[model samples]
Target: MTATAVNTTAVDLEQPLQDVESCLNLLGEALHRRDSAAIELHAASLHLALAQAIEQFTAAARNGTVPASLRTRLMQAGGRVAAQRESLARATAALDRAIDVLMPGEPTGLYGASGKNERKSAFGGSIQA
Candidate 1:
């Protein structure tokens, strides 16, 4: 390959990888602050950057194994993404537990009251609405 092709390939890999890293940094900050708006924005950015990186990496792989240094960076980024996912899963589970504590397994709505649901007589009143 020509020097220009090599340089272009390097640029393609480097920029997307850097964008992914940058987006992750911003996302981490937003998460730390618990800022919903910032989180949403950064999450979208991260998604785009990660997608671009995946495209570039996939193309590179089709041609040949990605160069080692870039592969290491990609692996590290993937690890960070996994760690973030695990943390979110834990948080989601805790939120679910809290909801359960606040509102147990009891039925909701007016019809679900214990004694009220039992029919006194078939003709006395038609509760069907």
Candidate 2:
């Protein structure tokens, strides 16, 4: 292929990588603010874009059409995506552990009174399980 054609293809491939980066940035913002909906949307979009770009890059590499610079960029982006997923999984597991530690029991409202004298307190309400 001509140099101009190869350059154009490289530029086209870069667009999707750029899109994935922007989506990841948005997802990070949403996660920081605990915006669940925005986080889900951005995460899904980023995943899709990254997957598509990886497929394209892999196909080009197999055909010996992808330039060395583009191959390096794709590999770097793939590494970043994998690292992000690992970070997300770790954060989720930490949150689960925190919730378990903080609220670790069924609500048993027994205001220190005997069963016979278990008259309800005015300020406390029983939450029936």
lDDT of 2 by residue, 37-129 (tens): 997898899889888887777766665487777778767766777877787899899999999899885545644345443445575865456
Best by lDDT: 1
TM-score of each candidate? 0.75, 0.67
Candidate 1 off by > 4 Å: 1-7, 108-129
Please give the CA lDDT of all the candidate structures: 0.84, 0.76
lDDT tens readout by residue for model 1, 15-99 = 8999999998898888889888998899899999999899999997786556678889999999998987787789889989999
TM-score, cand. 1:
0.75
* lDDT score at residue 122, model 1, on the 0-100 scale: 70
Candidate 1 lDDT score at position 90:
91
